[model samples]
Target: MQSRPSPVPFPAASAFPKALSWVLVACLGAGLGIVALRPGQAIPAEDTPMEAVAVVPATVTALGALEPEGETLGIAVPSSAQGSRVEQLKVAQGDSVEAGQVLAVLDSYEVRRAAAVRAEQDLRVAEAQLAQVEAGAKNGAIIAQQAEIQRLNADQQARIASQEALVNRLVAEENNAAVELGRYSKLYDEGAISALERDSRQLTLEAAQQNRQQAAAELVRLQSTESPQLLAAQATLAQIAEVRPVDVALAQATVDRAQAGLQQALVDLNQTVVRSPRSGVVLDILAQAGERVDAGGNLLELGQLTQMAVRTEVYESDLQRVAVGQPVQVSSAALPQVLQGQVVRLGWKVQPQSIITTDPSATIDARVVEVQVALDEPSSAIAQRFTNLQVTVEIDTQ
Candidate 1:
């Protein structure tokens, strides 16, 4: 009874509040340290270690695709005397064709056209020969030669005048190109256009200047050769006695030979079927069945799809970072996995990005050089399914 009365005098102070007080103080200190420490470092009391990776080298990625080694071959139909229509498109796009297989056909009008051209040329030659004979009979060989020389001189003068006009036009074009190039340069600096566009404008200017120079050279050539040639011909003819029957006979022989050539041309015109030059898949049909195209107009394009190469465009600014033989990884949407390749070639020229992404504001004129990647065998098998297929290429520049 006495012990119990003594124990009731003191209420046991709860150690919980004191422990909580110490805990709060410790938390405050720790929080302060954490807030005041290096930005991303772990807590001082933490047991887990931080992990990191060492990154080195770099890579460049570009969009491009598989092009044939020799590029696509273009087939065309010759323009005839009369315009020819495409009678048939025998092979459609993506058709596999053999060498000499007909890809398209032109109407028979081309045959008639070839004959007409030959005839016109023969008629002109005959008329000249007759005039030579008549002039010789009435006057002399010297007079005939003089007349011919005058005619040649007139023709040369007309050519010179025409070339001079061309030169003038080319110069004006060159000047305009220069102005445009300067304008493009300014805009590029201001970010109004892509670097590719600026470079393309520069190319146009250079081509214009080159054309002007060529025209000027042609004009000089005609002028330099015309008078001397005519004078020499006149001097030579003055020494001849006459335009004889033998000369007329020789001229007739020449006409006969030309007529033979005309026959051959006519035969070719009948066989106006456009054929593939090699065994390959047709990539494009540039001409329609009913369209009429002149000689050298593109009818269709063909290429061997078995051997494939990825063509990527690298930007001019980043071109310095790329080199031949760099390891590349090629990927296409058609394939389930990435394919390996090597940088077989680096482009000497830069051009615009040809395969644009879905971005509407993509720079179509971005000047980039075409880099070709020879694909690995396994990758090529997949690429063979698609010709001119777009792919992304990553070049490791390590």
Candidate 2:
């Protein structure tokens, strides 16, 4: 009751402080809003204290797949061994192999091996013949050859003398026949001789001329050269006296030819066996024993699993954001945790995206550039088993 009586109109001055507090609160909110909305705006020093803003690193993301350092390799038969079937597989899938290690043998192995053996035998025979030639003729052979040469020379002289005597006798007979023919012709022209007698004289003259010509040719042949037997005996004697360079050269040439043949045969034999070109693991075997290699002749698929990498296909538009040596993060449902890597290369060509996403809204026809990211050691060990596994990649652009 006393308070009601004393209740006077609230003073404007008393309400001034409360109204001032409400106005101050509103001004504070407006200042904070201005600072947040326009960060570049200058604030009065006497107003609110400034706070630091956090910054986040930017990133680019794309679909990717895990692979060996240099990607998978389809090991094929040597081109020289085309059309050959596999006779044996020395290594199976999952086996590790070193460069030049035998992985398979072709059907031509045994045949080629036999050919090589024959070539080797030929080489040995050639070498023996070369040694025999280089050693020169033995003393007993030299004596026999000299005696044969003397005998042939004596026989040639006697034959030449005999042929000369025969030539002289035939020449005399030819002259006599010519004189008789002249006489017969004169008699025939005078009609003093019978036609049969004239014909008989002509035949006698022709036979005499033929005999004379044969004798002359035989004499010339005898005088012109030594007997072939005599020449051969002389050659053998010369070879016995000293090893002729020509003979040695001929034998050496034979040896060289045999060696070349052996080399070629060995090369062909080696071709029958397929060897690895590099150290790697055999991921698959495309050809088995008794199986004919395909058109490509691929024998197996192999790769170096020691180091792993991610091949990411980034959109062409975002390619500018990627660079070599940049850090990367790779993740996949197949992996237990995120993996770390570094960008190592960028593709030179822009190609259509090959990896399709499960999300229907994704850009299926996006043009992309392949970017290679090499994984760290630990990450590589983890990814070794996941070759060709699709993965998500995040590249730090900062």
Candidate 3:
């Protein structure tokens, strides 16, 4: 039945249309294979064609780990109140120290010498005053007065003995004249003597009595006029006693003045010894031994390493985010470990613009604020880890 159908042939133009359809199908398969093997070709997720949308790429620049910039100032040694010379240095750079430790000493010779001289003068003056107070009077004056009193007493005794001898002689003469007068009277009564002899005997007895009365008056005068040497000596003794107490008081006052001077000198000498005011680590040494320094001169630099702090500079735009008691994270290029800190203070005024500048044209005239942060844990290990290290700090605004 099919051979019979072949007898009826088709038109050539119709065959051309069938060949064209096959060729078109093969070309479509080849185009699909080429598209599947192409690299970086993406297919849309959706079945429908999507409209084109315009997009802008964001401009991003990376900073150094994006940490806050910290600015620290280097300081030199501070001044000391004590004006002592550098006799000895107990610590050096990078050496640790304690509170109230002796740092150096000064020359104390001048002060000690002054004190000793004052003490010696005080002792000599005090001893001299004491001796003067103890001595009542001059020995020579006392001896002269005693000798005069003794001479006057001896003269009075000699006068009394001579008067007694004269009285005895006068009495014996009177008795002899009385006996002769009696014999003359008896002879006159017996008519063996004349009247003139009896009269002469009576006159002789009266003369003897007058002489005895004069001798007695002379003796009474001598007894009445007494020597004044004892009274003079008593007055001198009273005067000496009165002045002795005053002399003693004056001596005591001199001694007190000398003692006060000595004490002041000693105090000045003690001030020459220099010592540390507080405990800390030595940062630098400014002066050396035998160097003449002035008053309040710089000696050494010291700081408490156990208590560390971080200082950061915040830009004017970021100043609002910084405040007291805010948390911060600190990192240093020299140290691998990170540290935690808290903000302790915020600057009241903005800092000068020239401090944080790279180039003159790149510098912004806006002033930056300063912030101080206190570390949580400060130790020797932490100090060694961050010694002379440039640090970075990050603060949270929220």
The predicted structure with the larger TM-score, 2 or 3, is 2
lDDT of 1 at 88: 83
Q: TM-score ranking from best to worst?
A: 2, 3, 1
* Tens digit of per-residue lDDT, candidate 2, span 1-398: 45545566777777899989999999999988786865677755786788889975499999999999898999888788888989999998889999999999999999999999999999999999888888887778888888898899999999999999998998898888888888988999899998788888888888998998998898899999889999988877885779778888999999999999999999999989999999999988988899888567688999999999998999998999889999999999989889999999999999999988899989999899999999999999899889899999999999
Displacement of residue 269 (Cα, Å) in model 3 is 2.6
The per-model lDDT (C-alpha) reads 0.80, 0.91, 0.64
Give the number of the best model, judged by lDDT: 2
Please tell me which model should have the higher lDDT, number 1 or number 2.
2
Residues 312-351 of candidate 1: C-alpha lDDT, one tens digit per residue: 8877777788888899998877877898888888887766
lDDT of 1: 0.80
Candidate 2 structure lDDT: 0.91
When sorted by lDDT, best at the front, the candidate numbers are 2, 1, 3
Which portions of model 2 show Cα errors greater than 4 Å? 1-57, 139-239
Q: What tens digits encode model 3's per-residue C-alpha lDDT throughout 243-265?
A: 56677778778877877777876
List where candidate 1 sits over 4 angstroms from the true fold.
1-54, 57-59, 79-83, 88-102, 109-279, 286-291, 294-297, 315-321, 359-369, 396-398
